[model samples]
Target chain A: MIEAVDLERTYKLGDSDVGALRGVSLSVAAGDYVAITGPSGSGKSTLMHVLGALDRPTAGLVRIDGRDVNTLSDGDLAELRNATIGFVFQSFALLARTSAVDNVAMPLLYRGMRKSARRKLAVEALEKVGLAHRLDHRPNQLSGGEQQRVAIARALVGDPKVVFADEPTGNLDTRNGEEVMKLLGALNADAGVAIVLVTHEPDIAAHASRQIQIRDGRIAFDSAAGRDPAAA
Target chain B: MTVLEGFRVALEALRANRLRSLLTMLGVIIGVAAVVLLVGIGGGAKQEVTSQVEGLGSNLVIVVPGKFELGSAPTVSRLQLDDVDAIARVVGDPNAVTASVTSGEVARNGTREMFTSMVGVTETMTTVFDRPVARGQAISATDVDTRRRVAVLGSEAAEELFGDVDPIGRQLTLAGVRLRVIGVYAERGSAFGVSRDGEIHVPVTTAHRILGTERVDALVVKAPSSDRVEELRPKLEQALVDRYPGEEFSAVTQSQILGTIGKILGLLTLVLAAIAAISLLVGGVGVSNIMLVSVRERTREIGLRKALGARQRDVLLQFLIEAVMLTAVGGIIGITIGVGGSLLIDTFSPVPAVITWWSPAMAFAVSAGVGVFFGVAPARRAARLDPVVALRTD
Candidate 1:
């Protein structure tokens, strides 16, 4: 399980302090499917970054599998992100010149696995995303939906405890977005993997079992927790 | 990451920007080639000089008056004919010794005059040095004992001064002193740029009268056996050194002369190599500049690698390895060109050039070290970047 209590993130922009996340708290258990919803600058994306261990919080605490985020060094944080969770970005952050299989095998590369061994796991992950035939094709050669599928394969290749998706289908067409959503549904339902995604679409938020809404750097609403006292 | 994997990624990155990488490597190539070629030319020059010294004669010890310190002119010639007799007694053959005092003078025959080395020598000159007479007879002991005004002309000197007419029995004037030509020396070719066949010889006793100097410039003693030359050198040196305790006499065989010449050439080669290494340092600076640009250009890639769990050392090592790979490949190409150039020069040019085994090897090592030394700053900059900010760069 992953947990956070009153996490706060602030940035200094020349003369002013910009608070991206202020007193936001959340939790997700094993096999849970959750969606965080908000408008632009609502701190929903900032919440995901902090929870995914990509950015350090300015205040409060975060724990993944009972280990405090504050206790880890930068290198330790990177290892935790690599071993315990996977991230899927809206931009499909795959190496441009690399083949789909090589892109998928990148996470395992950090673990010092043999090239052949990691490639074998990559092939299986690509098969799950219906990208087995496109293994040797580069990111530029693949279609938008195919590239997203390759990104999905990369996320699953490491066999992480949970998958964090920040606007995963924001760049896809209607049919492709539905297909990617369906893939997430099956991954959660059949494989018992946890999924936490950020989106503004009400329809996308409706897919998850639990929903949380962030507004002005604070948690405005949670379907499970009802209305927050601090919300505007 | 594994070393092999680092090399793989480095190779990939360099291939992505082939033209820029090749341009950066050009400096190293030129530098290494210069070093190797200069060293080769120096080595070959040394070899040629050694061979010429050995070819002159064998088992002959050249004894000169002075302290005999290297790189200094021989100090104050005080040796005389009596010292020659002393060496002759030690060698157990009175006929094995010869003395010479030489100076440049005009050899005038009738209205014609030419500059030639005027050599004053004892009668044993031809016999001790194994030089043969082409015509007439060599100077005998009677010639030196009686102080006769007779001379011998080197083949080229005789041809140039006497022309088609036979030089023997002709009168030639040296230093305004008339002398009868007794014999013509056989042909001995040039050594370095100077001709050995342009010298004119007379008996030491007569040279003292004409040149007006009693001091002998050189005392050459022929050892009985070639094997004894090494042992006899010190004995002859000791005999003369004992006679004049404060003065040092040098008695050296042909091989020792070769060694001295070799050492001078070796020093010249080192100086040339040092000058070439400065260019190599400039090449290293070029590599550093290009690598800095590469680190900036690939900031996003660095962040992505770190996000994928690459540690700071891994990122540092990747860039470092890339820089080293560039210089190392340049070094290999330079070596090939350098060795091939030495061979070409040796074949097509009169200037001797030989590729020694160590020149290319040293050049290669220096180029690789250049990579390690210059690659550090840029690689460390890449490693120190904040992954969060780096990932956000456009």
Candidate 2:
């Protein structure tokens, strides 16, 4: 689970200050399938970066799996990310020239797992994504859809509390995009894992049970906010 | 990640770019080889010199005119036959003393002629220097007393002048003096790069007349034993000093000469090795330069690893290990080539190369240390990269 309270992130772009996330507040609970949609430069990626413990916020606080992101050192933040968070980038970001199994088993390397055990767990995770037969294939050897599925297996191999996927289907064709979306849906439905997906496409955001639209570094709407009885 | 994983990752990275890795290692290879080879040549030369001096007999002491301190003008010797007698009395062996003057001259037999070293010497050499006449008879006491026109040819000189023909009892001319070859000296191997077999020996009495000089170049004394040389050297020099005050007569033994030559050769070898180490230093710089380029090329990988929970220390260790491994492996290749080269030189050339154990050992350690010394900046740069920025690099 990830929670952000008025998280603000600012970056310096040469001569001027660029505010990526301006007072954004959001939270995702256990087993939640949430999508944050925005145009390019809407700060959706920045929000995810802060909430996933990858980037420190310029202001406010973020809690990932109950540990305050502000209170952790850079190394401690890395360990927290290893234990509680997983990430999937649009490019897949699998190491070049590495086998699918080695790529999937990468996160567990941070967990200090032995090679044989990591490989076994990676195979199981790949099997969940229907890629068991392609364990030894490199990313360059795989099609876009298979590479995304391998990326999903890498995200799932750690058994993290949540996975942050930013534009997961941005580089795939329409058919491979549908396949990746279907795989993410199947994993969510069968395994009760929380996912915070960032996307710009409407159809991609439509797959989530709850959707939040971000415009100008702030949340424009939340699908579940009105449904919750606790929200006045 | 484990150290094993660090090595695996580094090795994989290097293996991925084979040519780049090899080029990066070239500097270190040349550096280490130079260190090994230059030092080996120096050590071998030292060994050769030591053995040659010992070959001349460790009991040998020579009293040369003037001070023998390095790099200063030597005092001239006015030594004569009386000095030989005085040296013979001090050593208490008349046959062990020989006073000789060496001159470079053209020796002729028919139309065949070669430049040769002609030594005008006392007849006592046959008993003292241990070189025997291989054919015919040696210089006798009568030969010196009568100033005989007979000469003993060295084996190489014999071969050069007469070829397959018998050299003994044949006519030979030295400088312009007509003489007969009475015998041929046995083969004696070279010493200090000059051929011993090119010398032609005539009685010292005839030498004074032909060379037109009464002064002996130096008085050579062969003591009864090595211990006697040590005992006799100072006494001989003191006798000379007592006989002729204000004239410095330096009496030196084989070991003293060996010590001086060994020191000079040792320093020369060290200087050469140091000069060679400069290329190694440049090679270290090359390693650092390539490592910097590699770190830049892998910025995204560094970010990804950092994102995957690699600590700064882990990243640092990975790159450092890669660097140390690069230089260490290169160092090994260099040592192999250097040793191989030394052996080749020793076998195929006149330059002797004696590989000491420390040259390779020191070379290896220094090369590895060069890795550590030069690797720090690039590795730190890698370790300090931000994960968010790194992962975003294309």
Candidate 3:
């Protein structure tokens, strides 16, 4: 349900030009689980940003659910992000001082849900992530793994069609990372939500149904994988 | 977001930084307090002046024979009894007009002596000026017509000469002439800082016989109504001119004095209000600075909200509401302190300090306006923040 053609993103660093993504194109259909594996500075994060409509491409056409992101106004893009896409950062960006439930309710709050209703749905989402008992605990009160779980619950609370997770397991231990990857696999199978995960680890990429290896802003390989897609 | 949600968020944020919020509100508190206190003092002064001036009687007009010059030598002019008579005749009512001859000297009763102003007036003076006798009776028409050496003592004058004893029917020497006290006038408060209670009143003919003067220093006329003073003043002036032919005299109306005093007090209020408004400006600046800091610190929050579908207007409104709320709270506190301060001043100080109804309202309005005025820049900065950049900020 997402498409990109000839995406090029460049940044001006004082007197020099830095091309984050140079002429890359990709597509993913609904209910798909894909992983973009690349080395550091290989443009995977930039591509995910473009796909999620969080940032505009310098020169490209990015269509999500058949709507051109480049042609959308800033407010329209914000609405699109709220309604159709969710993001999970590698840092587990929960509001530092707020409760897990409030963090989960953040996405639904943007959808204009009433406070009580947002709380109810946020509790259910936290239960799905196995954090229901820790709903009132702040991020600081929780461990790194638990914080990441709260972030995952926040991403899924809005029930978006796609989730853009940038290194979702990058900050977790091996065991916690495996558990998180299994959760993503179960979500894809049970809920049929499309997920485009960016990771540098081959083991992490191995858990996706399809893998695209990116090198120097180009797709080096695209292939279907079948290693139980959850065991990595 | 709904207004209630916006307020809740603002309250939570402020509660999270209680010290900063209180510090920010300090400016508004002082500003509103200054507004209220300054206006209250000004209003009190006005009321005090009005009461003192009104006590001199509303229909009373004084005609002095000299030009009133400030910081200059006095140029004296002649005002005769004929001029007073002409003014009385032309006033169309003898009951509304009276003239006085005045002199100042030491009076003695046996070994007791006191410095006193001596006023000589017709028997109709009591009716025209509303000075009724407190003890004994006033000088009769026969006393003025026959030029009898009969005196009426003011309250202070009697007490100074007789030491609380009855001075009525007693003899006192004034200007080397022995006169019997026929009555004691009631106590009249200070006028222009001079004690009217320290004066003595007697017949005009008797005063002329004793002080050796036919010239009247002043003439006091009462108009039938306050509104008629303007209509009667020119006619009275013309009559004096016709009778004297070549002399000059000026009629001073109560309205003119009232207007002049009002203007002076009004200008004083304006000056004080301007000085107080500086505090408001300072408060506004404080609000602006605090809001700027808040916007900077909440950059991530703004980005998150924006990414969650909050419009630019919503973000702008949130900050603006916070600023307004801060100032409004300060204003309420300031008003409370100001009113309390005014009441304390009134209780302890001699000058009357009244808190008018409009002062609090004005203080609140000004403080709120100051909040909005200073809140604009920070609110705009918040609204214009780039969500992508803000989200990515560490």
Candidate 4:
């Protein structure tokens, strides 16, 4: 489970404070397929970062699997991310000049796994993403959709409790984007992996079993509530 | 990460910029080679001097008239013939001492004439210098007492003056004085670029009479055994100083001379090695420079690794390993080049060179130390980078 109660994040811009997230609260159960949608500058990405333990909130409580995020040191946070959470970036962020299998096996390396054993696990993860044939292809050698698949394999290789996807298909074509969404939906439905996807596209949000809309750093709508507070 | 994995990453990074890595390593290579080669030359010079002195005799000691100081002119010369007789009496051994006076003079035989060094020695020269007549009889004590005009030709001098004819009993003019050659010396190789085979020897009394010099220039004494030489050294020195009163002279054993020369050469090798080590420092700077550029270029990769759970020390160690690997490989190449160069010099040149095991080993250690010393700043810079800021960079 992932939870954020009244989480707030701020940035100091010269002389004024800019709030990326203000009084935002959300919760996701295990095996939940949740999509977080928002306009530009609406705190959707900030909430993803806070929930994934990638960044700390300026104020408010953020917890993952019932453990307080604020109580963890930097090293402990990295361990939490490596062992319990995985991230899929917008730009793929796979190491250039490195093979797909190596990128997928990277997270396992930090766990002190031997190279051969990690590579075997990485191969299985790649196979699950339909990239078994492209294990040796580098980021530049693969198509945009294939790169995203490699990134997804990297995220799943750690067997994380929650996967945070930040605009995972932002650079792909419409067909590839639909394919990636279908793959993420299956990971949640069949493998029972929790996914917190952040995007601005309505069609992408519709693929999830639950939807939450954010605006001006506040939660504007929740599908579970069956009503939009902004409209009410 | 394991050490092997760190090295693998470093090796790949270096291989990415092969030309730059090689150029950066050049400084360390030259530094190590210079250190090894200079040390070899210095060591070889000392060895040559030691063997040359050993060839003369182990127990030989020399008493020269004057205070000896390197690169400075001696102002005192008070050794006389009476002092030699007094020292001989103090030793109380007739076969253990000889007195010699030397000069450069022109010798003529028919039309072949050459300027050669001539030494006027007593009959004990054979025991003192370990050079005995090879072809004929050495001068006897009677010859020294009689002050006879007889000469001994060095092997080279004989070859120059009398072509195929025997030098024994041949008459040669030495500085306008004609003397019959009684013996020809055996061939001895060159020392310090001068041939030892082009010398002539005569009786000390004959040299004192003909050269118009009453003072003895050199007095050589042979110890009865090697251990006796050390015990006699201080006694001879004290006796000479007491006899001369205010005059200065030196009575030095063979080992003392070799020790002085070895000390000087050892100091010179250390100095040259230090100067050469500066190049290795410069090479370390080169490593730091290239590593900093690599860190900047790979910022995104670093951020990704950090996101995947790499610690600060991991990044620091990766770059540090790369730096050390570069210099260590360069050091190995340098040692190879240095040893090969020394061997070539020893084989093809007049100046001998010897490569000691410690010299190359020391050079390698210095180069590795240079790597760690210069690599710290850049590695720390890489480690201190914020993953958020680094990931945002284009």
Candidate 5:
């Protein structure tokens, strides 16, 4: 479970202040599938950053599993991010020149796993994402959908409590986007792991069980929706 | 992260940019080689000078009778035979003193006549200077007592005067007197470009009688041992002052020559090393510049590593290790080339180049220190980079 109470984030631009997030508050329970939809500058990404402990809220508290993230030290926050939450970026964000297995194994390296153990775990994670054949292939060598899948496998390798995906299908084609959404959906349903996905496309938002629309740094709409197979 | 992981990452990064790494290392290589080679040449020159000075005899002291004054005429005071006897008495040793009177332009054989430096010395001169007879006998006290015109021909002087003939029983004309050569001295190699074998020797009394001079030009004093020179020098100076009232003379000891030459050569070496260190500084600058560029290019990589739970210290250590590793490798290569170059020069050239053990160690230490010194700014810059900004940099 996560909670935010009246979060505020501001950026200084020369003489004026740019509010990325303004007085926003939301919460999600365990094993929940949530989608955050917004326009280009609607503060969806900023909210996700604060929720994942990457950035601290300016004026309020953010709690993950009942612990105040803002009170944790940088090192403690890093540990939390590494152990309790995983991130999937829109660009895949895999190290460009390294293989998929190495990319997946990177998070475990900081955890002090042995090289052989890291390789085995990374291979298994890749297999879970249906990317076992592409384990040795680098990001540039794989298709867009495969690369996204590798990123997902990396996210899952840590066995995190929650997965945060920011525009996971932004760079993929329609078919690849659908394949990635199905994979995320399966991860949520089968593994019972919570997922907070941020997207701008309505069709992409339709994959989640709950949709939260943000407008101008505030929640515009919060509604539950059933997954429609035909729409997907 | 652990040091092993840092090393792995650094090695991988360096390997990925092979040309840049090699170019960066080139500066350090040249710096180390310059330091080693320059110091080697300096050390070799010092040894050469030391050997040359040592060849003059380790216990011998020379008292020259001249007052050296700047922009003024030198007073050529002659030392007396009593001065040598008095110095010997003051030194508390009977066999420690010998008087020398020198004359130039003494011709021997007509066809082989050459300008020769003829030295007239007491019987103790040969033994004090460690000059042993090579072919025949040395002069006796009887020859000095009788003032006989008996000469000892140095190896070069004998060859110049008598050619292939045996010169032990031959007569040579010196200062218009016919002096029989009683012995041919052994060849003493050249030192400071002065050949001892090019001179002729006879008794002091004989030189005074033949050359029509009563004044001795110098006193060659040999101390009981090398350690006694310091004690004997002031005593001899004081005794001479008492014997010849109102006269001044300088006693030049072997240690003075060694110390003076050592200081001068040491200074020269330090200057050369300082200049070489400038090149090392330039090399360090090169490393810093390249490291800055590398940090900039790898900004995203740094962000990713930090995001993956690498501490700031880990990032700093990784870059620092890369810098030191590059310089250390360069130092090894440079030391090899420098030492090999010195050896090659010594083998093929007239100038002797000696490589000491400390030179290579010093070169490596300086090179590594330079890397650490220059690496600080760039490494700090890389470590202080904001991860969010770096990740957003694409």
Candidate 6:
């Protein structure tokens, strides 16, 4: 579960102040599938960053699994990110020149896993993404779609309670994008992991069980199908 | 992350840029090698000098005529035969002392001619220098008393002048005066850059009559033992000082000369080793510079790792290990080449070179130190980078 209360994020660009998040409040219950949709510079990415504990808010509170993220130290935040949340970036931010299995095993490296044990888990994660045969393939060697799958495998290898995908299909073809979306849907349905996806495309947002539209750093619309809107 | 994982990451990064890694290691290699080689040769030279001093016989005290400054030639003082006689009289031993006057001479036998120096000494010179004549007999004390026109040739000088013929009975013209060779010294090798087998020896009285000099160049006194030599130094100095009253001369023991030479050579080696360490510093800077560039290039990767749960200390350790591994590799290569080079020099040249085990070990430690010292800046920079901004970097 995740919660935010009037979250605000302001960045200093040279001499001027640019506010990315302005008084945004939202919550997602356990095992929920939510999509935050917005245009460019609309603060969806900033909200995802704050929720994932990657960046601290300029003001207000962000609690992930009941722990105040802003109150944690940098090390604690990293630990929380490692054990509680997983991120799938738009560009498939897998390490270049590293094999797919090795890249997937990278998160477990921080957990102090042995190489053999990490490799074993990485193989299983890769198998779940239909990349069992491409364990030794590097990012450049894999297709854009395959790379995204590798990134997804890396994210889920740690079995975090929540997954944040920021435009996971941004760089993929339509068919591969559909496949990735189907995989995320399957992960939410079978594993009961909360999935929070940020995207600009309405079609991508439509796959989620709940949709929240953000504008000018504030929640503009919140909808939950077959569920109470107040609970979303 | 574990230290092993950090090392693995560093190794992977370095292997990806093999050429750059080797180039970065070059500075440390040269630095460590220079230090090892210089110190090795220095140690060898000190050993050689020690053996050479020991070869001159134990309990020997050399009194040179003049005040001498380091790195400057000795100035001639009024050191006559009185100083030599006084030393012997003070020591209460008639055969304990001998004086030598050296002069450059042109030695001619038949059509062969050679330019060489001649030393004038009494028969006790053989015992003072531990030199026994290889053939015939040494110049006796009676030769000095009678001023006999007899000469003793060093092995090399004898070989040059007499060829395969017997040199003990042959007559050689020295300064246009004919003197019969009475003895030939055995083969004595060179030491401290001075040739021991190139000089000719004659009686002191004969040399004084021929070369027209009443003053000897230097004096040698033999003490009962080496320990007593130290006790006798002041007595020898006082006796000479009393005789001359105003002249300055130096009475130095053989061990003292060895110690002085050893100290100078040791200091020289240390200075050279230090100069070589500067290159190691430069090498460390090279590592730091390259590591900085690596961090910049891998900003996104760093961000991804942070996102994957790598702590700031993890990033720091990764970069630091990378830098240390570079220097360590360089340090090892340098030590190998340095030891090999010193052994090669020792095998091929007359100049002795001894590679001590500690030199390479110390050099490696310095290289590692250089790595850590220069690596901290870049590692800290890499560690302090924000994961958010780094992830956003293209």
Note the DockQ of each predicted structure: 0.47, 0.61, 0.41, 0.51, 0.39, 0.77
Measured on C-alpha atoms, candidate 5 has an lDDT of 0.84
lDDT of each: 0.87, 0.88, 0.83, 0.85, 0.84, 0.88
| TM-scores, each model vs. reference | 0.80, 0.94, 0.81, 0.89, 0.81, 0.95
**Which scores greater on TM-score, model 2 or model 3?**
2
Preferred candidate (TM-score higher): 3 or 6: 6
- Candidate 1: Cα lDDT at B123: 85
**Candidate 2 CAPRI classification by DockQ:** medium
Instruction: Report the C-alpha lDDT of model 3 over B152-268, residue by residue, as the tens digit.
Output: 988999999999789989999998889999899899887545788888888988998887878788788988888887787777777777766876666777656665676677788
Q: Give the alpha carbon lDDT tens digit for every residue of B1-394 in model 2.
A: 8888888878978887889999999999999999999999999999988887676678878789888766758766788889888888888879999888889999999999889988988888887778899999888889988999889999999999999999889999998998899999889878777898999999888888998889789888898988777778789989999988888888988678777888889889889988999999999999999999999999988888777777888889889988988999999999999999999999999999899899999999999999999999999999999889898887
Tens-place lDDT per residue, model 5, B40-118, is: 9888888988876766567888776544233345567567777877778776765777888888956768667878988
Go through the candidates in order and give the clash count of each.
0, 0, 0, 0, 0, 0
- With a 3 Å backbone cut-off (N, CA, C), the pairs that clash in candidate 5 are none
lDDT of 6 by residue, B95-121 (tens): 889999988999999988888888889
Give model 2's clash tally: 0
Candidate 4, residue B188: Cα displacement in angstroms equals 3.3
Candidate number achieving the greatest DockQ relative to the actual structure: 6
Cα error, candidate 5, residue B130 (Å): 1.7
Best by TM-score: 6
Candidate 2 lDDT: 0.88
TM-score: the better of candidates 1 and 3 = 3
Candidate 4 chain B: 10-residue stretch with minimal lDDT:
B68-77
Question: Mind giving the per-residue lDDT tens digits that candidate 5 earns over A88-130?
Answer: 8898888876789999988887787788898999999999989
TM-score of chain A of each: 0.96, 0.95, 0.94, 0.97, 0.94, 0.95
